[model samples]
Target: MRLQPRFRRPGGPWQASDAVLAIPLGLIVAILIADILTPPNLPLGPLLIVAPTMTAWFAGPLLTGAVGAIAVAAQVGAGVALGILDMAFLAQVLALVAVAVLVTGLCYLRTRHIQELAQVRTVSEVAQRAVLRPLPHRIGPLQVASAYLAAEENALIGGDLYAAVRTPSGTRLIIGDVMGKGLTAIGDAALLLGAFREAAHRRAELPELMAHLEQSVCVNLAQPAEGGEAGEGFITAAVLDVPDKSPKVQMVTCGHPPPLILHARQVAALPAARPAPPLGLCEMFSPEYFVDTFALQAGDLLLLYTDGVIEARNSHGAFYPLTERVARWPQISPPELVDRLCVDLLEHVGGRLTDDAAVIAIQRTQDAA
Candidate 1:
């Protein structure tokens, strides 16, 4: 399903309270202006000092200072012209104007900083879209949900990857682990996914589809050295083919973890009936390497994940316990289960991780209209 930026209230160390200051600032400005027109018995020029502060409280310091400077200059010029205000008062008004301008200048600087932050966020959001496209809601009637996290503190993309699509033959799905991290791994991941989509539709059988992927990578690996190509890079992927209304799903393991099966709210590991060696290797498969089959049921869910989820090591170096963690979450809809699993995994790692992660969950939905 499609994802959105998780919304949370803006949080930070500094927050100026405008509520308590708004009314008082407004009333003070009102009183100062009244004194200007209706001269009071007592000189109220000193009270005009707070006029600029009202702008800071409501519109932020930058606009506040501008208003303050204008009010102070007008009051000073008028008072001196009328001969009612003394030299001391004129000096006081100039000082107040200078202070207001200084405060507003600081506000202007902060506003520029905030704009820079917004620009950075926009760039991040675009990169995320280019990296992880929005997931489809239903792939051949299997309700799907996914969660992806980049390794770095503020990263929005990563090396771990997954994709699912429905074809005439069956529903094609893949989950893979790129060897390393950073932009290089992400590029390889993109190539892998691009090949998988086109090849999954072209190949006649599971092994053939796997071969198509290997060949795509091999072609790149064999490119001229000047092309910035690496000869031995490879990814471990698990490819699945599930037909419409079928009770069993055919799959091949290319050095990927076994998919978890969820039925009636219980989770179990689906045995790889006959696992195949990972793609991109010559003579890597033995006679035993063949397509595995999983007997599925209505409402059954299959989960494919990258090593990031399982290999997440804590400060103590103990790997994350994924199987055990899911065992505790009572069965729910595919989306809900996906959500809870993500939460549980994040909690396991203390809300942060050093490696990228990806999770793909598919549950058979009631027949579509």
Candidate 2:
């Protein structure tokens, strides 16, 4: 998926915030005038440092240095005007120059740090798109839309993941959340998604596909990670197979939240009759994975999401009402539905989520052949 573009000012180097530079420039002029008007003993040249220091806050090193030079020139002009080019006045000029240089150096460091941060964000976005490949907007008779949010500040992806593959007989979809948060969880999420995309096309049966995923997870967790113990993590996931000509969806819930079916004004949560254990912990329970079949009529929407959606809490500590909220917009398009739910979910949590969230809306657009 393409990452959203960040908002930028239309102009070149100078941004809208650069307009504030006028304040510091005006300060320089005021200080110069004050120094010239004041008595020779009460020089205001030292006050000129304020201009460059203030400029450093909004402008980069080059602009800050230029302002500092102007401040220094104004101090010299003040000295010449008052005919006080003595040791005392020279000391004030040197002090002003020192302060200006200090602030300019700090500005350079700040600008470099921001550039580095932008690079990291760009890399993370690339990784996110590669791992969670975008679901086709139209796959066979299904219309699909998905959204993902990371809990980590400035991160594009985290533990939550989702992907869809178009197979010869059907469309296979998976939405999952790894055990942890932040960058630590990305490795496991990528592993699961990679396994799904590769195995979805090869495995004809939903149970077989789910079994392969569980085995993949088990093998992955059994190996010790860098400085961490082995077999320490697990993932909650829901996998679905929607055949091109079938009027039903085959699903296997592995310790994940149930998918909700929205038809007209009704919202029904499809909980698996015999849900399997989460991928990595399947060995602890019966090895068999059961596939539950649910009717998916034309125009019916399937809502799949990670736990982050329902677990989102407001200021009052109440969880978000996903089913109730979805029932209100049952007839909306898949894209519109996903967009609305994402917006509402963020608002319910006061604009910051405590966990990584992923949501997918799939609508069956035609009847079975």
Candidate 3:
């Protein structure tokens, strides 16, 4: 029987932890019951702390805050009614309320801010979907995975791009970086992707398809900025073609950073034979863009990323250790590894990134049984 391969969807909504909420709810009920049984002399500090913390887990930050406030109020009322309301008890209650109020307020603000963040993410995602969108996990004989990080504080749009499509010859891939960041960068990325997608499918030669993309950029820059491609900024990119399912990958670069090859716990940049100036900067001269070949082995992983990831600066303004970090990741499924890397990378930056960054990991899977 022939087996149909299942593909994984990339870049979707973050699933809230049901356990994080459930545990808190259970703890709240248990603590309240214990409070009822033990009455006045109960040590409820742990319960109180857990109450506010639980609020954040279950009902989200807003609901968590409200729950925390209610818990604090209940504790105060119970203490007073049970005759445990001495001066010392009053100080403790005051302290509990103060802490609870502060925590809940912060959670509330975070929740509200997250809502606004969701809106921006939705816009950025839609902007990308209409332009670049997601790629199929498998194309003919190839298996693929991709990750994108928009370096705009909490915004989700970036100038980095990658695309793969199977054609008459074989599977062709385009990994490129548009100059600058923000909406304008997105415009340049979109233009390059649109032209490459159309031209790659129709044009017989790789050079012609690349030429078409450069032409598209020129035209996009010529028009009254649609979707924010202004000032005729250029983009650096690379295109790959693996014709006839050969073990060699033919590639052309446009002043972009070189991609890294990961094999058997070792990661190294693919050596370039010759490179060319970035797209949109071709008006002054006709640059000689050379096409080089690299050997591709099954089970090997190729990492194509824009400058945002490697160049991400920490508090000390130090660049992220990409080679060390990726090497540290366990060789596992694409999404799991990428998720871990994302956490590790963000933690290094103390939370979020400052520039647009994208990472595309393409792994060659052995032919399945």
Candidate 4:
């Protein structure tokens, strides 16, 4: 059965909890009634602390305090009804209030910590947007869809990167992964993306654009660090140029995974015509790069992804069979295809991916001759 896309509404840091607050409050009332009706020796006053503590987990400090106050009032009334206005009953009431105050404060601190995390996630998302702008659903003669899964589950951006933009020559795109994860790789990705975006517009040839990216990385990597080697990192990338007027796609692979072309219910990996080294290490050996041109028919879908997807491992240590899995969704749209792949990938790996994964699906529309 085909899985439908699930839409989730955007929520803020201060979004209300889905739990019913009235249930806890009613339980507090029930506990007070039981204390008043039960035998004097039953001693149900201690149970009143549970009300405020429960509220603390799901509510703000003010609401927790309010619940605590109600609990304290019930305890005092119980003491009065039992005719036990002695110092012992007074001590019990004091202890209940103290517990309430402590629980309320703790809940407040927990809420604040969650809010801080939400704020951090928000900031990361904004930064990711600035670095990796949203890809268009339709670009020239293609229907496009892309997905990125960060290695850090909570992060909005990761080492895996992709971009697609229309140029005078054609619709140019790149998908790549840096050597490492976190901020440093993100920095490299941002550098590569910036270079690609700018150079794709100015350069007419695909190889020249690739050279521009390599030159940018070489310059950045050559900069001396505080205690590390100048050329300590490299990025594995694949660049594709789909001409606006031709039913052909040109590709250049740089120590990156070969792209998969899906057509006629089969997935074929498009190997580069000539091997090329990663972007940053071009200064070391000066490796030669070449573009491989493939026929892209109207119904053909071109998929570019990072190693994270292929290298994803299950409990049995088996890498994900992307080609085999992709065969199951031959008739789906580009967006649906991407969504299905993401869901299946996560399911194959037991719901958590250790590395960052990124994939872009571009289907040549029927408008193409």
Give the RMSD in angstroms, all C-alphas superposed, for model 3: 9.7
Candidate 3, residue 73: the lDDT equals 71
Model 4 RMSD, rounded to 1 decimal: 4.1
Best by lDDT: 2
List the global CA lDDT of all models. 0.71, 0.87, 0.72, 0.84
TM-score of every model versus the real structure: 0.72, 0.94, 0.65, 0.89
Q: If both were scored by TM-score, which would come out higher, candidate 2 or candidate 4? A: 2
Query: Which residue ranges in model 3 land beyond 4 Å of their true spot?
Result: 1-124, 224-230, 330-333, 367-369
Model 2 lDDT on a 0 to 1 scale: 0.87
Worst 10 residues of 1 by lDDT: 5-14
Candidate 2 regions exceeding 4 Å error are 1-12, 15-17
Clashes of 1: 0
Model 3 scores a TM of: 0.65
Segments in model 4 whose C-alpha atoms lie over 4 Å from true places? 1-19, 38-42, 226-231, 367-369
Per-residue alpha-carbon lDDT of candidate 1 for residues 255-360, written as tens digits (9 for 90 to 100): 7888888777778997576666655554354323478887667678788888888988877888988888777766567688789877877777877877888888
Cα lDDT tens digits, model 2, 1-369, are 225433222224656677788998999999899888888878888999998888777677888899999999989987887788899888988999999999999988887777777888798788788877777799889999998887887777889999988898888899998998755589889999989989999998888998899889889988887787885788999999899999878998999999999887699999999998888885586557889998999999999999999999999999999999998885899999999999999889889999989999999998988
